[model samples]
Target chain A: MKQISTRLSMAVHTLCLIAMLPHECTGDFIAGSVNTNPVVIRRIMGMLKKAGLVDVRPGVGGAYLLRSPEEITLLDIYRAVNAAEEEQLFGIHVNSNIKCPVGRNIEGVLQAEFQAAQSAMEQQLSGVALKQLLSQFKE
Target chain B: MKQISTRLSMAVHTLCLIAMLPHECTGDFIAGSVNTNPVVIRRIMGMLKKAGLVDVRPGVGGAYLLRSPEEITLLDIYRAVNAAEEEQLFGIHVNSNIKCPVGRNIEGVLQAEFQAAQSAMEQQLSGVALKQLLSQFKE
Candidate 1:
């Protein structure tokens, strides 16, 4: 049971800290909050940075949201951390015996269903903004 | 950028073959259609067998759906193959620092959203039956 990477949740957790405590979001500080190593937080922050969801201030070492919390949906964070994995959320075995009619066409038949199912999950993700998740947190 | 295991799709493909060509579903046959090794087919079939979705004959090595195609939903196959991974489809990072409010509460806040997103995906899967996928395949 290989699980989907934990990067997605870690990215979300990273972003929450950035939103909740912008001044305190140095890599180490954030890593402490995430209960992981600084290197892991740095890696996830790098992805977030590339996605234009967050920006890291150089020299001083702090991060902040590039977009408003409401503008950044869970889908955004999900894509940021897992852009590569999302391209094929559901993988069809490539060498499916082409001789068998069922094998030959199974991939093509399952294609739309996989996409629909992935889209349904992402649709729920897109519905939840980082602001929404942030508001759910208690002081 | 890790992806969910291929076992889910492979299991579905195996089920499709079993339901479509009941008599020819020897492990080798299904493996051929799946374009994978017999061992791979054996592993997936074991999961399906354990779930009681399919029965494997002892002597000659053939498999048949324990339930009709209509009775078997994609969700069942999904569960059969990836039961271990689904317990927490969206895992919250386990070590969030309890000292920080956001870190301490992020897992709890995100729990419902993760469950909802997973449910949306599973809902789509459960809605689709093996019969529906089989009907889409060509002769």
Candidate 2:
């Protein structure tokens, strides 16, 4: 309900589709499969392309694979999409001033813990490769 | 910088302070410590109290420990304050109609993966008890 980023999910979904059928995907085709706008697919694909996960040709040309499915982890896609990390999944605590001792140190402590949690999340994603996701593509 | 939810940070900071001292805490006091409004502290405390993490007294009263520091985890605090799962961190993919096959299934697939990742995150947070966080509390 909260904290899980949609961009991360979009990235994984797109990558999995590509990994399932490499060298034959296009932004428009993938967009149709995802029921989203071609422009949106292209945006995500742009990120994937930048991450070296996909190789794309404009206009008549299509998108292809540049990396092995096994080498592409969910974490890879997450980072590729540049998923926003600073935002909390839900609400925030009311802001505090830096002048106070508790407020001064609060950011550092919370950030450290959040970083640890994030690391755990990344590790979990890393455990699932694009190949793994491809295996689930029963379509 | 953009999405750093002050809520989680504030909750952790507030709880850590309460856990540090062997005394009752008030929202006003906690707010003062965090340099924020007491109303915000009260809101957070309200949720914490509901979660059985803290005991709050209304009308000229303060908050006290309902659960031991060692008994609590960051995940517990997160759940208490968030009132929802962490997987929906950045919100779900919008603009895609659920009537479409891909759109309908997209939420399910993304939800599953997000839950898996969230479970892993909770596991990590559960491993780190509030006692540990309190111990790390710097003066």
Candidate 3:
């Protein structure tokens, strides 16, 4: 089974940890929790920071949410990490024969449906906040 | 931009030709319209065959739709071409630390949301029948 990038789930996990245990969330700690390298955590944290979802402390170190968990939607993290593949969730055959009506018009026709489907997924992500997601964690 | 697979679009293109120009839709001819290799068309056509959407002529050669264009939805093509990636549209980090609450629970928590999001996308695709799509083609 092929899924989208694991970066999205990692981003959400990073944020959930930050929200749950703010002071302990250094790159190393988050990495340990995420079961990945600190470099991976740093990279995702870099993306999260660039997206304004989280910010690091000055000398104290470790990262913190820039906004509340309730304010941060999964779509925010999705858009943050997936900036490169923004509107390309569904690929079309690039070089269709121009003389063929179906080939000529498939991309244009499929583009609308692809965009709509992608948006429907994104809309579902938007509806789920980090707060709601974190609430599911065991005590 | 990483799109799912051109196979979905190609599958649609393959079926459209079969529906619109049934007598002329040999694999080579369809490949010409799709602007790809006949091998690629054959592979996709094979998947469509396994999915019961189309059938190749016995001795005559070329393909025809087993079902009417109205009976086949984009979702059907999406599933057919993407059989290997069924229900994995959104990926979660695989190796989260079990000792950590966020790590242990993130996959479970995110699975529901991912499923919902994936379902929403599938639902949209299901709504778009191939008949509806071909109607948008130019005369």
lDDT per residue as tens, model 3, B44-135: 98899999999988579878888888899989999898778456888788878998878878888888899998998899889989899888
Displacement of residue B44 (Cα, Å) in model 2 is: 0.6
**B1-139 per-residue lDDT for model 1 (tens digits):** 5566788889989888888777888888888788778999899999999999999986887889889888899888888887684476776778788888887888778788898998999999899989988887755
Among all candidates shown, the one with the greatest TM-score: 3
Model 3 DockQ class: medium
Writing each residue's lDDT as its tens digit, candidate 3 over A1-139 gives 3568888899889999999888989999999989889999888889999999999775686888999988999899988988694567887888899888888898898889899999888898899999898778857
The alpha-carbon RMSD values of the candidates against the true structure, listed in the order shown, are: 1.6, 3.8, 1.5
Question: In terms of lDDT, which candidate is stronger, 2 or 3?
Answer: 3
Per-candidate Cα lDDT values, in order, are 0.85, 0.70, 0.87
Q: Cα lDDT for residue A106, model 1? A: 81
Best by lDDT: 3
Candidate 1 regions off by >4 Å?
A: none
